[model samples]
Target: MPSTILRRAACLLVVLAVLAALQACSSGDSKTGAAVLNPSTLSSTIPVTRAACTPFGAAPSVVQAALDGALNPSCEPGGEKLERWADSDGTMRDACLFEPAAASTAHPLPLLIYLHPSLVGTDLSLDVTNIRSQLETADLSGDPDRPGFIMLAPYGRVGTRYYPLPDQDYSPGWDNWYRQMLPDGQERRVNGTTYAANVDAAAIDHYLQLVLAQGKVDRRRIYIMGWSNGSAMATLYALNRPQIAAAAVYSSPDPFGAFNDPCVQQPVVGKPKDDTELQLLNPQLPIYHMHNACDIAGLCPNSLQLRDSLASAGATLIDDHIIDASLKDVAQCNALCGTDPLANYAGLDAPGGYAANLPGYAIGTVNHLRWPSSRTVDLFDFLRDHPKP
Candidate 1:
């Protein structure tokens, strides 16, 4: 062949190789194709993974002690109190409240309200011992003052999930709602409401009001954190109440349709259910989401999309941590594994804790990476910077 013909052929081969390389990255490796996060100047993200070993060990006492240290001198760890408040019908609801030593009416403090997961075993209250244990390992506790913060973990009224509504469920709104049992044996209905009063939203609201009344709450710094289904509910609750400063969610998909908990619902009939509504209430609401590439729930994709949308709309901040576990695939990630579960595995290995060995992560397990991936970033530290205006 002529020299000109040879040059043209070589260029064609180079183009093909580049195209092939691009295809490989988009499959599931790179957060490029279908990525919901916007790389614009407004929003930013820094990916980080959990520690090398399981921070929460097999021993319950050890885990508790570790959590105690994480919260530090302001509050003694391992101790929890059950707070009971009146429901709409004048009945009582129970939740676990954690108070730092600095919590006093004279000096206001930030409040962190946590919602439990969708799955419920024998216990109906927040999995403080387990989930919060992870937070301890991550050192992701609140700090309103020098070394203190306020945390409230509320139990779910139906199916152990935060039923989305600003108040307790009444007859007309939940009048036509249906009822059924969630896979985890909790009773629930997604038609907005049912027999069970939705104190998840209402109860938390009432508690906030009570705290405000007590004059110990720094109203501008109030926030919420939830995992799995509860994470979705966090956004739902934020939609109704714009006063909430920020939200930190994990495992729940960013997009509205990642995982379907037909039972987890919005109790208010005419209330806003989509992003359009969320934007109207709080334009600069800061949200930090932990999404794993290995999630069995298929929540990462939508979560990324939502992150982008939020950034585009001028959100105060969107910390989208996309975890990538190359070896853990859809089937492998979703397997009935966990024989060697890591720190604070809640499903099968609980109360007693799990084997320190990992990779055989907990059921519905996704990427094990939690917390900000960068060595310099700390979630708890970042949270303190943003106080509501």
Candidate 2:
């Protein structure tokens, strides 16, 4: 084999190994939460259809190889298949697409655009939660014609240009205007770092266009969801594209420049700052947001700011909550709380993972990092009701 191919293969393997290790450590055991719902429990079923997708642009040999192993349209029935599309700039971007077995051209299904968490790429995102299967089962339980929806979970690029924290290395994550911008509208980063612009939104738009052209999607029911960093991306996308019917997110940070800092508890402005660049958010778009009460000190308060700002802006259908810490899954929280430095400050005492009982913070496990299996049905239930008006 050529040296270049050898080098590429080596690099890919290392990256995969690191990602696998991270998943093993962070995701915890599968049985930590509620049991996954069985599709057999539902009365409806979708017939499996063989699906196929073609690559739009030429990808590096490493990415192409991964795609070969991960995406096989000919055999996959109701599973996710990876595909690469060319950006306007001709760079290849990857996304894992999921189509239910019952999806047909005659009856279009809803389209779901899921943005993954930071450092968690497209592949790991699917495994992060059983929400995907729960959603599929929920869709199947409904009308037969619209048995399931097509999901597109796109991979984010790692770069200092988009998110530049001096203490953290660049990893896969979505771009956020509030997190990256300073009070004066300049990029927030170390002085010498090379700052770049946004391509994630454009890439997402391209992905949506590709799926829409397939004629198997119902444009009116398009919805988006995100976790952590991706939540900000989902919010920004819903704001920009009125075509999006609704948005659902978990533990999202403040996207309106209010309480953007994890260490700082105060808003950047005098009050909950909503008049930033994302102030143009449409008030009519339905938004469902849920935050963990024992999350990072700033995040739960940030959720409040997000909720209040949007509500004050005349957003009619907004649902926000700060789930009590006692209601969280102790096992899952125990697995995740150790990884976050702020977990102790939240007074999380989820067996083997907390210290210091801080007053005013919730007293229990830290449910901020992991997706509790208990809420999957509720989240999808909300998305199912509100289609674009």
Candidate 3:
């Protein structure tokens, strides 16, 4: 009887040992499985469809067709004119196109999309040609040896109406005209001004398609620039489209929100709380942001906030400048209420000021709107230096 009892005890001990060993193995497997399922380790497999290649050197037919498509006119093509392209929603909008003087060499020319200030009274037709000429004078294309490039200035809608009198009725802001939406659903101004539909993604895509069809533009060299609200839109485009090589924004506001928004956890495209679609779409693009110290339109703080957000997302801070002093030109200074001068660091400590902040960015300040001769020169130089990574 004693021997039988001992055998039973030994058998029970062996069974318990096997169960413990199995439990240990199971725990180890679970840990390994968890490690494999880490979010960072998961690869994004979405395939991107690249636009058709347009070589630097192409037949005249291809080039002409592209020019024709981009500059399709409602009336006979005469002097430099404002033309409209329909958006996905079938809304017509305005865009200005300048064909580079016929190049002697086949060097592919860069295409620059210049966005205008939303508060400007005139459209692209009024100042686009002059602006292009100024850019050329600045030698913005990097080298005279190269083919130079084409310039396209798209008009943005006004956000508000300027009342000659302060007590007069309100006017439409630029965003309202561009988006065709009310401000937080407000009413339109008496001016009845609207943005040309061509500035939107659909219209921009069509314009790109026309460029691709021409087979002369360098797809890798497309760029964007804008001022004020237009600058904000340019940043939005760069954020949403991977094809844009680089961007230069002047006096622009933050697209998503202020710099302190906690939702902007990182700069890697999709990590931000707002505009997830935009972040996911264009993860690897460069941005150049510029702002003044005393921007009356609230552009200074907005630009700084965006710079911080972009830095947090692992974006390369290419160039940054803050102009706070009064302009030397008495007339220009007076026009800008003496805000033309670039301010010192002390001048930026006021409410919604930008001073002592941006990391890994080039900051500067100068007189206001000196055109391609001054601020634009610096901006375009930065763009030429940094291409899409």
Index of the highest-lDDT prediction = 2
Task: Give lDDT tens digits, candidate 1, residues 115-232.
Answer: 6554431133233334344332333334423345577665544322112221112111111112110111122322232223233456566555555666666777777776655566
The order by descending lDDT is 2, 3, 1
Task: After the best TM-score superposition of candidate 3, give how far the Cα of residue 316 lies from its true spot, in angstroms.
Answer: 3.5
Higher-ranked by TM-score: 1 or 2: 2
Q: After superposition, how far is residue 112 of candidate 3 from its true place, in Å?
A: 0.6
Model 1 residue 291 CA deviation in Å? 1.2
**What does candidate 2's lDDT look like per residue over 1-389, in tens digits?**
69999999999999999999887766432121111222223212122121220010111111222332343222123455556665433556677678776566887788888888765565565676775775445562246646667787776655321221220224566555422211111221222332222356666766676678778877678888888778877876675456677888887765543221221211122222322222232346678877776564334555666666666655544587667565443222222222232222321223222233332133322355567567766667678787765
Better of 1 and 3 by TM-score: 3
User: Which ten residues in a row are the worst by lDDT in model 2?
Assistant: 53-62
* Candidate 1 runs further than 4 Å off: 1-92, 120-145, 160-199, 260-280, 308-317, 325-377
User: Which tens-of-lDDT digit does each residue in 78-143 have in candidate 3?
Assistant: 224444665443445455566556422265666777766543422432253244554334444566
Model 2 residue 8 CA deviation (Å) reads: 71
- TM-score of each candidate structure, all chains considered together: 0.50, 0.60, 0.55
